[model samples]
Target: MSLSPFRSALAASTLLAGFCAAPAFAQHERMSVIANGEKVGFVDVARTGNHVAVQYDVKNNGRGPTMVEAIELGADGLPVSWTLDGKATFGGDVHERFLRTATKAEWSDSMGARTATVRGTGLYIGQAASPWALGLYARALLKAPASTLTALPGGQVHLDKLGPATIGNVSYQAYAISGIDLSPDLILLDDKNALFAVLDTGGAVVREGHDADVPALADLATKLTAKRYAALQKRFAHTVDAPVRIRNVRVFDPVSGKRGEPVSVVFANGRISGIQPLDAVASPSEALIDGQGGTLMAGLHDMHAHISLESAILYIAAGVTEVRDMGNDNAFLPDLMRRIASGEVAGPRIMPDGFLEGRSPYSARLGIVADSEAKALEAVRWYAARGYWQIKIYNSMNPAWVPAIAKEAHALGLTVTGHIPAFTNADAMIGAGYDEVTHINQLMLGWVLDPKEDTRTPLRLTAMKRTATLDLASPRVQATIDRMVAGGIAHDPTAVTLELLMLSRNGVASPSVAEYIDHLPIGLQRRRRQAIAPIASSADAAGYDGAMAKVKQTLKLLHDRGIRLLPGTDDQTGLSVHRELEIYAEAGIPIPDVLRMATLGPEQYMGRDQELGSIARGKIADFILLPGDPTKDLSELHRISMVVKDGTIYFPSEIYPAFGVKPFVAAPKMTLPAPTPKLAGSGPAHDAMDEFVY
Candidate 1:
């Protein structure tokens, strides 16, 4: 149905008449906010006179307190004013506000102020708007062309009506909204165009009276998003019909930890078929490529990534072909894996990690949360049956329960890894059966935190300052490292993850991402430079600097002691991996060793060494072509010219543009070489080259 301006006018007049007079009949809608099948918050909507008002209060899953957002909408349904005021994810402050005027709009948040010219009836979408205002936005977009909208201060939103779904005995039309940076969100409205529910793969805001329908509704939301992204997968993936050949490439040999001499590689059926010297002859039918004598290394692996479609694409564009998804929305992760496997989307091969958190008010809400040891064990078993590579325990988990959970996970053949539970130390976890530890902070916080400090709060991130003063040579610190070395515990320090938390200062660009800052969106570049943990005094700044320095020192110690380190990015996808390796190099690890740790180490840990981790004959064709030798300069890893995953070709230039990222190089176009001239003093050019193949 087209948006009838006259009908909207009539509806506005009717709402004014009814709501202004009776007030109690002010078209109200309310929903219970749910995550992990638990009710943590609620959303209330009310429209009166020529205005619509919505109030949302939800204690998000894990570490997120009760966050509150309020929106006041004008008669045209555009936001007149919006304010998000509360701590949500990771205890980040949620003081965001947007005000729209007749000719302009302005917004202010932790990132600072943004102003944009308003044309016609402009809209304002706050960061907290997803899964809450999606319904309201859907209703407003009925009048928009192509159900498309240009978001305020910049960006765009493309909305799609995904037919109808029934929740709680009521038939409602569902719509999917994309282009929000986060995952696609699903919105539902009743026949009368009344907001019914807003849902995502993890949680939902549904009508208060129909609380039992949230799960099914949440499932519907996941399927709807999957369907949408599957369509995108078809559009983005590129596959070749003929055998492909790449000539003149110096391949990185993970086993040798060095770049080999220039060679030509031929691959088909998603496996490397042969590796010949650069002058090797190629058939006319082969899809030939000139590598320009750059480095071709095994596709990189990120051991500690939180997966998302955008992040997956970004990873591939940066030459990362595989990822170990640390924690995510339970239903969404499996569905995403299916999409990538089926060639419905372009993404890295995912190795799943089951996330288990303890039930506490401050619990981080990404995965399953257990309230008891038995429940935690059950969660572990649940993941084991589904083939999870590891089980990650998080804050809020009872430290006492770690032994039982880890024991069962180990018995079932899953590695146990996680943050040091709140009020617990790494010594206890390592003793209990932790095979790996994630995040450098989670590993070191136990030494710095007061016994009663709750990691479920910001203290986990802020307590690192004490590390600056920590004496690692002391028995107390050395014992922890000793235990890790003795127990063979692997560490994914994610040192780069702490850089922003510790070193980022107000108004200063991140020294870490300075080389590629211009390639990102302005808002992101601004936000990236902002401090995550504010430094209140010079002492605090010094403390943070000391803490960061100490982290590198600890990393060097771990490396020197033969403690395995897995390179992973808990930050942005592709570039963050580069930054992670860069930090690894700064931590005194040689560039070759860092590359080996990033590529071969994780593969060996995952037990895929026989088939992966290098560019060799008969191995999977997953590798990236860089513009320069990464072993000579680790920074060259950031400039991925092309990526080949399962024999599907993707150019960073082509993929970057889709995500608004400026490509670092042009797409590699295949050019059949001219017939080889007679080799000087040689019987045949091909004869000399074939001698090196064996």
Candidate 2:
């Protein structure tokens, strides 16, 4: 469910918001947009007097934004007038404009138009600006008092100097610009304060001819980000060395589909030691957590995810203790997993799935890109040897190579899953030994599309419109269902993702995210309200509405047919996992079953049920404390009070504020053991005292 297309557009809109960085004296400049060490696009800027024009394009994995920006800079180095016209990543039209006059400031974007009286020098951040805008922001902030400025529309921007670094005998000053989103943008500027590069772990937009510096800059970005997360981990992750006792909580047993009577769950050394009676005697040495009659359930699992350092903490905050990474940067994921395991960072338990794609101009740059049959089989072995739970075949994979690849993966005891390759259907892949299909659209497209229709592009998404008129009871649809049922194949619907793509409208919050939208950051709030799919007319909008209805119907049909449903949000945020389960319940699946799919079902699917998934003596200590029972109302998941992953406790109330989210609930009362006092005869009183820290 990565929805890389829409995410790329959002990333381009936000990540490159300040990319316009040419000096007024400069005539022209060019830069390369590098993603995962590969050049994906470029930003070209031409200046004539006070007016500048920017042409920005990024093409990766068959989708990206192409933006044209025109700007008029004021004497203060902020834009007085700016216009952006472009095609968004998923081919949606983008027309954003901002103008500031002597009396007022006005702007219009996907979020609609607004005006405000002129107060001071405010910089307008475009929803679809080029990479040059970041440079524009950096340069202006450098001259402002304390390197801070009032940003237009809302919010403030603050810049911090990150000192200087020398790469290849060239020195550049690095600075982090914050107050824009959940994370800061780390950019390097030349001696003149001109934008040198915008760095991120995923990619970098480097000044032209400085591509060689991308790798180093990206590594630096990762280290800087990791340092911030590490500080948060130290601040939040509470590791009680002694046994922890959570009292007055009812345990939701997935097997029985009901909550037991209030009891005290005790755990130590990252394993549940006992489930005791509520009236059991208390141990003075144990840490006490008062659940206050809340429900204690096994930590939820997001069956589909692409984990990042930021999303890792979000997952914990949302009660997702485990995540199945659908695909990710091969070089980055292993280290991230290691850090999570060693308590160096905060994140969910990651079950890695190796990504395999065929070499092409549109290939995803995350994992292995095989250009031949041998390379494909080699990828299967590479994943097997490295302990990946499965191999995910992507859009560009050759259908002809799947059989051999699946065979190799099966022989190595790894499950086969992924998008239905371009020019092929789900039925063909299932016949070729696919244990599961990645997305619901990937599965349904086989029934609605012709064999020659290519799904390697955004067609896989836009073509879902055809399903609006598709008959569920048709023989063609049944045949695919029959195969899936007979083979016990699973489906990762990522239903929330479809809701985002098909049902989102400009300036209106999508139904799936409406419940929690107001609690998010302004940037994310705006992103969620805008449309990802292009809807030019009422008819087009109706088609998408009907398509979403059909998608739900298809989900109901699949679940009714006894097909395995793996709840996943191909989205990065932990909040989307809650929405994913809600969609399942909304589609008529029982709430208890949806909860099971999110918790125990995934553990069972991955053959780790014996050690994980539910509350029991000797099982791993991974569960969340909620104020209400999710088995009755799935939305209760949003009210998670505390999450314990492998015995380390985290309070959602404490984690949300770091990302600008309003806490859903206050943390439960936690009481640690009293510190021991030193005796008069003890040598060195400080060394003899017991200090308890969270």
Candidate 3:
């Protein structure tokens, strides 16, 4: 929603109360206006020279409050200003929805720019400043828009006008329909209300009835809306949190920093109220299950996940309780959120972001296709309504747009984080308004290094040399870090992402690259995995080692400052996270702390310590039983005996990531006979080809 109102008619007086930006002395007064045999509303004016302000309001003569969604006006009649935003709801009427402008009305003039939250209800018709004024309210209204076009009786493109009508107290108009997707789709119309773009969606149908806005056209609107709010209804049902109890388990609590202990855990009414010794179990009415002496720990969180049924199911199966979805199609988000929360589907809790792009080649591929500052602001609002938790400003956004979008996101209670291109670095974004800077490279690029460039990079030989050592002790680097600390900026140090970025070894993805390819969806496993396959023909092992040096320096700097490091792996499958822990050790995080980084560090960042992030009395039952303590043989984590997420159990180690219809349980892992012969480490064994690190 932009700061301006839908029309010049409403802008004068709205938002004037105590607004520092509003002009002074713009107060309401008595005024008269007559039309259609009744008085509606009029503007009260005050002016000093060229600047003037007006105050006004519309009074409903009808039983309900007259609702208005838009008021467009501007010089040359181009609707230079509009405040059409946010959907409208009147009391108990559920089907009513509203749209003020074709898109969120982003405001600008020869002057400058500002953002708005389009806030409205009911059917709204006509062009900007149409001279047609009406109040809307409703009793019985639409049920759902017709969303499935395939099942409809018949349709040769139909053109019908819907309203100047009312059902209780709302209005709407419908016209020119062709190619309504089987799933409910959105059709972008120009001011003439003629279709400009038809967008496919898994949307709920619009509820409708015959009335004035366009009686003959009412049925057409109904036909246009079809799909079952299947996605939404499914999501809404799953949000229920059932009571769970886990008894007799050794717990590893992150906050308490405790491990290797047995405890009885109880969860009821969605909160962990107690944790006692395994022998001290108390009776409670909830879903109680015995942990059977297995180790219990905090729920694992994946920093990045793309929403898909298979992926979501796998997240829960893998013991990941929550995930942060970096970016996805904005239009699909609202219903997606509803479905996830309703528990209509089984998946980890998700946090989504709306795409924010600049004038880059990748713009339209995501929802970021924007050109100007105003366009960028509208993109933010467009996603804001759909439930994106943050503004994921992408790699190609203009440096200037970063500050503007960040400010708007803050104002809207949204955080800004993501990759900014070479044009804008982390320091400037943080100084401007970035709340969190993502990826270790961005963090490093700000103070540590110029970064290892690719074939397209234009670099100076001297700068390349500086990329080796991050002068953490340097005053300049410390100063920037100090500000980041003072500002409470969270660093999602995905060390694995950096490993991939740095490991262009002969262009093979990495030594571990081919391993993850099997975990991908069969239909897409090859196509998608091929793009990132090992960097064969790429640079050699030396480049990887150089990158590791900065990564190590980054670790020391973050450790010294006591900065908050979110253990996130851009690695989708949670297994990659363990690999990340190993890499964390390589980058120099002591193994114990690195383990904590995965188990507890994330919970504290989530601010849900009371309910999650460890194995202890009264904690949610989440933890994995490893073949051995990860503190000793860090690789033991790979040999998980059992994994419990929210108390549901799964065992995947025996499966060994083989791409199968299902992970097989051929037999539980068994202890092998005593080791046989040993070989000298001074000589190359298994794959001498893999010993490039030396």
Stretches off by above 4 angstroms in model 3 are 1-247, 266-274, 281-293, 446-466, 469-476, 504-509, 513-540, 615-627, 631-633, 640-694
Which residue pairs clash in candidate 2?
Answer: 18-133, 18-134, 18-135, 19-131, 19-132, 19-133, 19-134, 20-132, 20-133, 21-132
TM-score of each: 0.85, 0.95, 0.54
List model 3 lDDT by residue over 217-327, tens digit each. 222323332222333223222111345445666666454445666676665544455776667745432344455555556656776554443345445545566777766
How good is model 3 by TM-score?
A: 0.54
* Candidate 2 Cα misplacement greater than 4 A, ranges: 1-25, 144-147, 677-694
lDDT for each candidate structure: 0.73, 0.84, 0.45
How many steric clashes between backbone atoms does each model show?
A: 7, 10, 73
Candidate with better TM-score, 1 vs 2:
2
lDDT computed for candidate 2: 0.84
Q: Write the per-residue lDDT of candidate 2 for residues 1-694, one digit (tens) a residue.
A: 3644224223533221222344544689898988767889999999887788989898888888888888886665556788889888788899888887766888899988998777545656567777667766777687678988776656667788888877668999988877666666778888877778887777778888989988887787778778889999999988887899999999999887889999999999999999999999976578888889999999998888988887899999999999999888887899999999999999999999999999888888878999999999999999999999999999999999999999999999998999999999999999998999988999989888888887888888898888999999999999999999999999999989989988988899987789988887666777677888888889888888988899888889999999999988888779999999998888898888887888899999999999888999999999999988888888899999999999999999999888768899999988786555468787434423244432
Q: Who wins the TM-score comparison?
A: 2
